[model samples]
Target: MPNTTDIELRGVSFAYEGVPVLEDVNLSIRSRELICVVGPNGGGKTTLLKLILGLLRPDRGEVRLFGGPPRRGRLRVGYMPQYGRYDPQFPVTVTDVVLLGRLGRGGLAGRFAFYRAADRKAARDALALLGMDAAARRPFAALSAGQRQRVLIARALCCQPDLLLLDEPTANVDTVIEARLFEILRELNRRMTIVVVTHDLGFVSQWVQTAVCVNRTVVVHPTSALDGNAIRDLYGDEVRMVRHHDFLSKGGHDDE
Candidate 1:
């Protein structure tokens, strides 16, 4: 499955309560690909992710993942939403927060019983991957924004997914944090496909060859092919590119 098609969308159109959002969109994401989903506000970027996740039904056309319906294929996917719905006052520990991810695989009964040793190990491994293992006992609400983001991403990884979806993982983080986030993403991309939804047009990770632009419709363009016209089409003429280096590193991927 190293080079197999992981996600496919064909002639897909979606409307929310009769308001047109995306129309006639076609896309394919291959295994182990690192993709950035970029577009202007209200351009249906989030909507596109929802469609692929099977959270929303398309008005027309087909959406497929791993050659099947998203609901089935999604078990292999890890998702980090644009927003963390947790109340800041909620006193959940970092490890507890991550264990929530295991619910999908652990079943509702596991929620009442103690987590299995395997589940605990998975949670620990996920925390270690994000370099937050040291803070596993910390309160979730007490962590900084960047730290919280990483913890959420760790939760996503707790599912041990083959496809990872992150929505604005760098939204409010500083450039340093953003850089670090991408560094982790670079590492994660090796055995799994990654889809990042970001507004950062300057996001030029060397390994990210494709930027899927969604603006009512969808367009796939090479990062190098994104010039002013493409920027204008995606963001309505409000952007400037800032280059960043030192993201990719040589390594073997998690192809298993």
Candidate 2:
């Protein structure tokens, strides 16, 4: 079911200086759904997510989130970017990093320091929810790739957002860990709307209920089901999937 309460973008276009990145893209994201945006490199995937996040305004069309602009009610959004590298000697603990998510709610200028009991409780609870309680005091520099990824998600969850946006959530993790991350996202989707941008064909077919493709142009497939034709339409006939099964398998998986 499409979420009745969600975001809608009509004829949206964005450009950097005079060069266009996204051209008249139309999209709608429903509440309580998981949508994946996929495309080749330089395909404006990141640009589109930035538009949803309201970090950049569209050059031509309108974007509405929850009945209004993304900027007006951004606190309800949580975002986790592609895996980030950290300095080994940064000296920040996992708990400290997760606590950063509360900065928005806690206010700025020393406001977070005077945390109410509820705020502290929320941060701790978020860490536990992501299974990071055991490493709450561990230095972020020392955590493994998968553990760090979970911490980033925990940081995002601390906001208790109605919508969560992740860019390349499995970019650096191994396949086993990537599968686990997808499962975690499936569970998360039951509680919040999720929008992910990736080139991973495998995850898209297995997890997403909707697909959005951007390549200077954007197309949205609202139906959860997809076929080889749809895949080829977006990625051309060159991009290949690991497994030899299409989302609507019966037909052998091939980009063409």
Candidate 3:
């Protein structure tokens, strides 16, 4: 088994400009679990992520990681942001980007050194795991969208994190690439806990064992067993759930 439950949000609340985004949010994620968070566009999904990363503080209650504060929790967490936006002119190569993940474990000066042989090996191994070893020496700007995403994930994995947090790991990819990405995620989750925020509810139900549905308030489901009424209540009419009978009659596939 893994260490402690890797994450906990204790009655957390957050607001901006006097308007609340998350209220009375309480959640606990155990080690080696794969959880998917789903809701409408502005349902505080990202806000919850920020709270767990300590990028934002809760207005009312505490957020803890490994039984401590989030900043102190950094050593155990690996975070993959929704978008990778470095400039093409930037001089970093894929190796350099992945090596950045080692900084937390190796100290601030680790990036400048040749890096310990073990650390370099760890970075290379992470790349291989993500199937991005060929692009390891390529300039980060030269890779395609899916390749870039895999590299970012490789970078996060280089941290040897116990808990990995991802925001829209499949956001802009086509269907085929998204399927491949989730396959990788399943393998990763066997060793590390994963918490991802995504709008693609169907994509996660295929693999995730837990669901966190958030709006102003948050609810937890054992699986992605959300019904039409629950979907309507969470996202309103503009994003209602599809009816199974109607969808089947129309020959609509579940993967759509």
Per the 3 Å backbone cut-off, how many clashing residue pairs does candidate 1 have?
A: 0
Best by TM-score: 1
Clashing pairs in 1: none
Model 1 scores a TM of 0.83
lDDT tens digits, residue span 208-242, model 1: 76888776778788667666566455454332111
> Candidate 3, residue 140: CA error in Å?
1.2
Off by over 4 Å in 3: 1-3, 106-112, 224-256
lDDT (tens digit, per residue) of candidate 2 on 114-166:
65666668778988876789998999989987788778888888878888888
- Candidate 1 yields a Cα-based lDDT of 0.81
Error of 2 at 206 (Å): 1.4
Colliding residue pairs in candidate 2: none
Per-candidate clashes come to 0, 0, 0
Error of 1 at 228 (Å): 11
Q: Against the hidden reference, what TM-scores do the models get?
A: 0.83, 0.81, 0.83
lDDT of 3 at 58: 91
Per-residue alpha-carbon lDDT of candidate 3 for residues 207-236, written as tens digits (9 for 90 to 100): 788888776688887654455465445444
Candidate number with greatest lDDT: 1
lDDT of 2 at 87: 67
Per-model lDDT: 0.81, 0.76, 0.79
